[model samples]
Target: MKINWGHLNHDSAVAVQSVLETEYNFRTTVTKLFLQKLTDEMHDHLEDVQFDICPLTKCFKISPATPEPVHAALKEIMSHHLPKYKEYTYQA
Candidate 1:
């Protein structure tokens, strides 16, 4: 998934980065710089960016131009981590 870790605290972001890399099989590193930029630019496009108190990253930005593999990865994440959350979304 194309996770943006900027909204989270430094340590939490690092933990998320580790999980995405090690457990989720993502090879690329998720750096603070990358996330900082994402936090800034992402808001320009998306209307709703939700944050939870779960100590993980606050937001999940699924780009309209999101690639196939990333989309698949997000699907896997939602299935495993967000089963209780609603699947349907409405754009305003």
Candidate 2:
């Protein structure tokens, strides 16, 4: 969540030493959020969406508190993009 939020607020002016990191785009994240399997209904993407009204009658939206799937997808993407395979010996 922190990483995603950082994407929304990227600051090249104050970067930490020598780290090679690019903030992921927020738009892509939104697209992924609504990606549904062929079996899923059109509204399945909205399963986690929460809406509410403030005291002033202004409408607002809140994302799901649980982002495990997003985190898992990130882990999967990182592993595939930057694989670290250990040396192995195969014995038959």
Task: Identify the leading candidate in terms of lDDT.
Answer: 1
Clashes of 1: 0
Task: Give the alpha carbon lDDT tens digit for every residue of 52-75 in model 1.
Answer: 222242233344445444445444
* Best candidate (score: TM-score): 1
Per-residue lDDT value at 48 in model 2: 45
- Candidate 2's C-alpha runs over 4 A off are 4-66, 84-92
Considering only N, C-alpha and C atoms within 3 Å, which residue pairs clash in candidate 2?
A: none
- The lDDT per prediction is 0.38, 0.31
lDDT of 2 by residue, 1-92 (tens): 22112121334544421122222333244335445321244344334432221212121122234244543443344344334311112111
lDDT for residue 71 in candidate 2, whole number 0-100 = 36
